[model samples]
Target: MIRFETAGESHGEALIALISGLPAGIPVDFEFVNRELWRRQQGYGRGGRMKIETDKVHILSGVRHGKTIGSPIAIQIPNRDWKNWEEKLPVEAGDPAKHQAVASPRPGHADLPGALKYNFKDARYVLERASARESTSRVAAGAFAKLLLRALGIEVASHVIRVGHVELERAATWDEIVAVTEKQDVLLSCVDAETEARMKEEVEEVARTGDTVGGVFEVVVHNLPPGVGTYANWDERLDGLLAWAVMSLQAVKGVEIGRGVTAAESFGSQVHDAIHYGPETAEKPTRFTRHQNNAGGIEGGISNGEDIVVRGYLKPISTLRRPLESVRFDTREATAASYERSDLCVVPAAGVAAEAMVAFIIAQQVLEKFGGDSLDELKRNYDGYIQQIRNF
Candidate 1:
């Protein structure tokens, strides 16, 4: 099975990731992997931490000369800010006076519950691991998955669609999304400039109020082959897997596939895609086609040869500039929640994380459908499957 895990604290020395079950002889692209990390650190409302950390991955194992050897891949991303934090958070015990203690837990954060779970008097221990910085390793792993998927003609990308009630009125085209996301200079990461401007205004307004804002983003997967996921098992459903992946991101409160939520209100005829048969060409035979993609490139838990569209809804960052009411863990006295340096909004960055997650899931599914010990072997299996699909 394709599996991966990430380890490290928010302000720890470095983040580590281990990914396994990939075929050998697949090329690893270092620049693209680092670029994915860079994309996650971007966005208009990011905090000072983004200014401190420039995430870049170092692959330590599972590849020889930039290609996988079909073994587990291990990577590390150093925390540049660890220098300033070394005295406070050393691996070896340091001075008690140097320790940074968080007694008051933020209301919406994982501080209180996590502290209670671990019996930690200081919420710092909880908040450190709970921080969204953990996603850095995820983005790194996803970048690797992206390289794998790219080899098979699949591409994943994401862009913001709404921010704090400032929603894009219409869906953006594939070209528009690629044009905006690929650019080095991006603000809200929205394809519609005017909508992004309004989103900026919304962020500015929220900033003035010492509050945070949430928003929605869409991840699009292109050139995916049909019949990858199965209807035989509920746990193997593509929609379920996609939703779970996107929802796992920090601050992401909701997830949807295609017109998932809207379909609930519409008639069955309006919600479903209409199918048609296409004429065979010189390079291909007769094929099934759909005029609309309201199903979001999936039907009955399987991909139907359309672009897979998934949307994630992120809640506002829990750490407020103006603290909320909370009781101190030690004192048990009510007070303003402790203020932590946090983003005014993170929808754009969250979108990038969501893209990574989607890519990883699709890559996992692709591997599961076309398993092999080497790239050439996997490609042969994949090509044969495509031929079978086209002929069917």
Candidate 2:
């Protein structure tokens, strides 16, 4: 199975990620991975961290001369901010009284529970790893997965669906969606011109008021092959994996597949996709296609050669400037929670993270369906599956 792990702290020397189980011979792109990392730090209302750091990836190993060698890949992204924090978070233990800083507990964050569970008096332990800064490694690893999927003609993209109280003016079409996303500047990543403008206004409003606002974002994957996942086993379900991935985003409160909540209120006729077949043609004939994509490119836990649509709802950043009222961990005295520099709105950034996670899930599913020790073997297996589907 294809899997990955990332280790490091928010303000440590560097963040490291290890990804394995990729078939050999798959060519990887370093520039694309670095670009994705850079995208994650963008959007309006981002805190001072973005100004301090320009994220760039260093590929340690796993491939030679641009192609995968069928081994685990390792990547590192240094924290430029670490220079200042070296004494605070030293490689070796430092003076506790002078350097150690504790927070009573921040409302709407992992601070309290994590500190209590780990027996840490300080909330720093919770915020360090819990910070969305960790998504940097994910972006690095997931961008590689996206390259693999792209080689197989699968494409994934995401956009902000909401920001603060403003929803999008309308859902975007495939071509229009690509055009908007291709723009170099990604303020909010919202496709709707009018709504994104309104959202940006709201973000500015919130920042001036020292408040934060949360919103939602959506991702879509197109041109996926059918039968990549299985319905036979509950654990083999593709939708479950996608949901798990989307929900794993930091501050993500919910996930939606296809029509999602809309399906609950509608009749079966409206929810189910209608399939059609036609005569075989020389160019693209006999290949079954769908009139609708209500299942989000999945049926019975497997891909159905359609577009996969996933959505995520991100909560407000927990480390608010206007902190919430809470009791101090040591004295039990009522006071405001510790303050931290945080984004006023992160829907656009969350969309970036969502895209990475979605790509990772799809990569894992593809590897499971077509097991190969090398990329050439994997490609052969994939071609065979396509031929088999055409024959069917």
lDDT of 2 by residue, 1-392 (tens): 88999999998899999999887888887778888888888898999989999899888889899898888999999999998888888777886755646567888888889998999878887888888999998988889889888887778888887888898867677676666557788788887778889999989988877789899888888777788788888877999989998898899999988888889999999999988887765433237877888888888988887778898989989877877898888888999998877778888788888899999999998888887887678788888887787799
* Candidate 2 off by > 4 Å: 279-286
lDDT of each: 0.90, 0.84
Global Cα lDDT for candidate 1: 0.90
lDDT against true structure, model 2: 0.84
Query: Could you give the C-alpha RMSD of every candidate to the true structure, in order shown?
Result: 1.5, 1.7
| 356: Cα error in model 2, Å | 1.2
Query: Candidate 1: minimum summed lDDT over ten consecutive residues — where?
Result: 280-289
Q: Write the per-residue lDDT of candidate 1 for residues 195-293, one digit (tens) a residue.
A: 899999999998999999999999999888898798989999999999999999999999999999999999998998988988855432227888888
Clashing pairs in 2: 24-374, 24-375, 281-285
TM-score top scorer:
1
Question: What are the clashing pairs of model 1?
Answer: none
Error of 2 at 66 (Å): 1.8
